[model samples]
Target: MPIELKMPALSPTMEEGTLAKWLVKEGDSVSSGDLLAEIETDKATMEFEAVDEGVITKLLVAEGTDGVKVGTVIAVIAGEDDDSASAPKTAPAAPKAEVAAPPPPAAAPVASTPAPAPATASGDERIKASPLARRIAAERAVDLSQISGSGPNGRIVKQDVEAAIGGASAAPAAPPAASAPQAAPAPKPAPVAAIETDIPHEVVKLSNMRKTIARRLTESKQQVPHIYLTVDVRLDALLKLRSELNASLESRGVKLSVNDMLVKALALSLIQVPKCNVSFAGDTMLQYSRADISVAVSVPTGLITPIVKGADSKTLSVISTEISELAGRAKEGKLQPHEYQGGTASISNMGMMGIKQFEAVINPPQGMILAIGAGEKRPYIVDDALAIATVMSATGSFDHRAIDGADGAELMKVFKELVEKPLGLVA
Candidate 1:
């Protein structure tokens, strides 16, 4: 049998991706784990590998094809012993009888559900559930093993898990079902007004990265209740410490940036005020023990946050080196999924760009993000007298649903203290 190679979901949030390039062509012999293609997701370009030894029969999707949906057949691979000439040249269509099969068969019995459950429930074995279905199951604590698949070849899918959940909930003491009155239909939204222009302009299509960014940020602003807290922190002491450390560390080729110090300070601050280092999960709050800071780096495509894991415990030099490497790879779109996926908190520094204070949208799951502005010479109170000092406005955007105003303030206070003190970050 010829096996169909579908577009793999490179990331958890990936629904579709561009077929950037094909490394193998029809009639090419390949072994398991051989590089098959390069797929460009919303975040980065990832290499897809062959799962079975086979001879490529046909390429269904051409290179550079955008928005190829996940699970859409991209190519066909015939078995090692199979003749390539006899392999299917296209995706095999289902028979009319199979297409006409009724939905009642899927709901037949709970025993049928177990047929697909073994693939996922076999201890420590990889599950063959769809990404969305897996996420839904995780969030609902519904065991994947108990659900029967209704998708292709007994593959567990979203509808199957949902149906299983509904069945289970209904199994508990059946309530007298009453037909509730249907609410009035919602009114259609007003169409967006088109912009009038006399000058000729090009209609540039948005890239996958830009589209994902737009969608995620819009959702963050709309769904997350954000509370912004700004504080002016004197950076003179931190700057002095950085210079001194750089001079001493010059022999080792290690130079620390202010952003590196900021990452450390934020991590320690989160450690001091654990309430601020949290994620807003519906009906629950996730309090993290380690402070992993996602530092925002602007790539050509868009912005990406590569995380600095355990920043609180790492030395400033280590944080500086790791961030440098991560940011470089991030800009090149070479970061792996794990490098930019999850973080306890985030820090977005536009200080180097010389931007003044500006509020940032909160990244979902993360409760807070520290936005750092340029440090400029300004009037400061020293011993009750006005003096010159380098001051920078740092704003902390918090998810009000997850972090209280007081806790957010406390985290900011601690951050300022660590930065001004300049020794706690290194110690």
Candidate 2:
């Protein structure tokens, strides 16, 4: 029997992905765990491995095809004993099994075109519109029958519905029935209409990573009630300790960074102030036993947070090594889902970019994110006398729903104390 290779869900939230490239072509013999295709998910471009050993019979989804839905059969594999020549040759030709949904067309640049005539018997005839357009039409009370579609096969997309709402006379929709089994979901913001301009510019489609980042950050700002607390921490002691530790470990090639120590400090502080290390699960809060810190690493596609599991319990050298490796892989778009997914808290250090201070948007579910700024020599009180000390401004953005203002402040205070004392990080 021929084996069907369907699109695997790369991430928990992934419903679809781009078939970036095929590592194996049709007619290639594959074994279990062999590389199949590189799928570009919302977070990263990860390689999919073959689970069943067989000969590649047909590649249903071509390379560069975007929006391939999960569970959609992307390929057909023949058993080792079966003849490869007996399998289907062309993609359009159906295999032995039935395929419900075909793969989407290869990615292409989007261009707006004037739609055809509007105002037809939408009641009798079936309406051809995208799901997003239908949703927007329902919310804005825009009659689809009065609007012309501009998408493939004259299908109405979000832009079409938005245009109708803007120019077409739309009557107000009646309120949803209260006796309905479930309430209507919150209306998502409509796509922004393109503006006419004379400025020379090129339109680039947003990558999955960029799109996800935009959507998530917007949701965070809109939904999460944030409480920000800032504190200046002296880094002189921590820097001194880092230097001494690096000198002793020079032969082993394990050098410590200020950010590495700070990672440790933040994890330790989370352990001490357990209230801040929590996730907001509506109507309840989840407090973590150990701190898993998500360190923000900027990749070419977008920003990703690779976690250091149990940073509070790991040694500074171990944390430094692990961070370096994780960051390298993150930039290469090779990080697995688990490596970048969940964390008790997050830390974003823009110190290398010379950013003085900036409030980071809290990643959803997690209670808070610590923003680290550049450390510079500044005047500070030393033994009741003013003296120059290396100091940095750290800000904590807490989800007011899960973590109280006092808890966030205490986390910051403890973080500051750990950094100033320096030895507590190792202890």
Candidate 3:
């Protein structure tokens, strides 16, 4: 029997994805850990791997194919002794651990030839490990047998493997490097009564990311009731601290950015005012214990938010390093799903772009998103007298359903104090 290759759910919310490109073709011999294809989802382009070894008998979907539903058969593989020509044509039962909608019949559990163990240190005994974990463990010369796994059924995942090595180097998952999200572009209109333009314009097709962004933002505005709170923040103390810290840390190759400090501040503020760090689930509200700040990084395809998990707990240098790494990977479309999936709140900084102020749309399910504006010299009262201070506008857009206006204001107040006092950030 030909082994069916169904699209695996790469993400919790991913229902379908674009078959961006195939890494293997018909008659190609594959191993359990080999990369088979690069699947492009709304979030990122992730490489798919084969779990079972075989000769690729057929490719059912073409490269660049879009809307391939999860659990849909995209290819076929024949085992070493199977007759490919006589393989029965049938609907594929989902693979092991596959989460299929209207799941396969319980009585007829899909039987399969066991895949060769992927663990690099396997002998008579085999350790179950993901291809990524196996690869990482091999590179690091770490023994999989010594480390227990945290993944499903004691299967080792990346995080588990990394923990076995020097754990501090492993960055915690935060929300993506995003705070202020660029408003999702307006949706494409219906075909009827379409306007024809004489002015020259190219019809740029929207990628999965753009389409998802549009649909999601449209839904956020229409569904989530948002309350906006803006606060003008003094930057002199924070700027002074940043410069001193950067100079002292120069020998260690560590530098902190204003945005990095702000990420920390926002996270600390969320911890202080837990009332604002909540998501509205129908009939229930989820209040996060720690803040996972998503900072937006712009990529060629679109924007992606690679999280820095516990921003408040991490040092400014650590936060800066993680953001740099996450943002770089995000641009390259190399981030794993876990890096950007969930967050307690978000922060989008437009300060570098010189934008004075703007309200950022809430990334749904996350209660609030903080929009940061450029800091500039502004007239203000200092020491009970007229003075000029470098100030930036920080706006918190809260989901009204989950958080009250007063709670949102308190969060904003705390965020401002952290920035102005500045020492609190390092402490």
Candidate 4:
């Protein structure tokens, strides 16, 4: 019997995912746990591992095709040695599977004649419009060729149409329509001022991750009462330790970064404050024994948060290595959902970008998120004497509904202790 490869649920909030790429093509032999397709969920691009040993008979969902709901048939695998030459080729042709695939995009409308265009000033000349404008006009049922162009290329601009249709520059408006319905209707107003314009914009569809982020963040802001607690930690010793460690390990290929140390410190802090390592269920908060910290990475499409599992148990070196790998993959959009999700908490660090401090939205299910800032030289009063010190400010955004202000304060204190004394984190 053949088995279906349904779109795996990548994140708790993922409803559908994009088929980013397929590691195994049709007819390729696959084994249980074998790497299959690379799926792009709402958060990250992740590997879709096979669960059954068989041959990839067909791919119902092709690469770049998206909006596949969770558990929908993404591919089909035939039993060992079974020929799959007759399997369906496209999603539309696939037999009924567990989860239903979305209907195909509607066909383009056929025109009886070539699309009508605005009359250009030149005889028999067609309107000069940007490609995007042309497409937008088609979609909005606007007659682009009819509008006059004010652009350098004599192209029809959005404002041009608005101007043609009673913009500020439009001729003096005629009397009210009710009063002058019989008289010639007033000419459309043109823009009064020379309105500055930009190149027509393009509308790119949102990726799964962006859509989910928008939806979840919007909901979090609307539903979760968020409270922020901030603390500036003096990182003189940590920076000095990191420099020494990097110098010693230069040959061993283990140079450490402030962000890496921060990740390690956050992990250790979680151990002391396990309450911070929890997710809010409807009535109660569920805590986890292990500390997995998801670090946010920015990509071309949007942000991806890849988790460093067992972070508390891992040494600084291990954490650094895993974090580098995960970050690289995140930029390439190659992370698996598990690699990005399943974290008890998250860290959004913008220190490298010279950000002094910032707050981050809480990635759902998780009760806490730490926003990191850049290290800077500042004056500090030590023992009544003012001295310059390098300190990095960090803010923890807690779900007030789950974590109390005192608890948040305690967690920040623990984090300060571990990071200020870098040895504690490594030891």
TM-score of each: 0.77, 0.77, 0.81, 0.66
Model 3, residue 318: distance off in Å is: 0.8
Identify the runs in model 2 with alpha carbons over 4 angstroms from their true place: 81-86, 89-187
Report the number of backbone clashes for model 3.
18
Q: Per-residue alpha-carbon lDDT of model 4 for 63-89, expressed as tens digits?
A: 887776655667778777555654444
The candidate scoring highest on lDDT is 3
Give the better candidate number (1 or 3) by TM-score.
Answer: 3
Global CA lDDT computed for model 4: 0.70
- All models: lDDT? 0.76, 0.77, 0.77, 0.70
Better of 2 and 4 by lDDT: 2
Prediction 4 TM-score vs. true: 0.66
TM-score order, best first, reads 3, 1, 2, 4
Worst 10 residues of 3 by lDDT: 107-116
Candidate 3 regions with alpha-carbon error over 4 angstroms: 87-195
Judging by TM-score, tell me the better candidate of 2 and 4.
Answer: 2
Ranking by lDDT: 3, 2, 1, 4
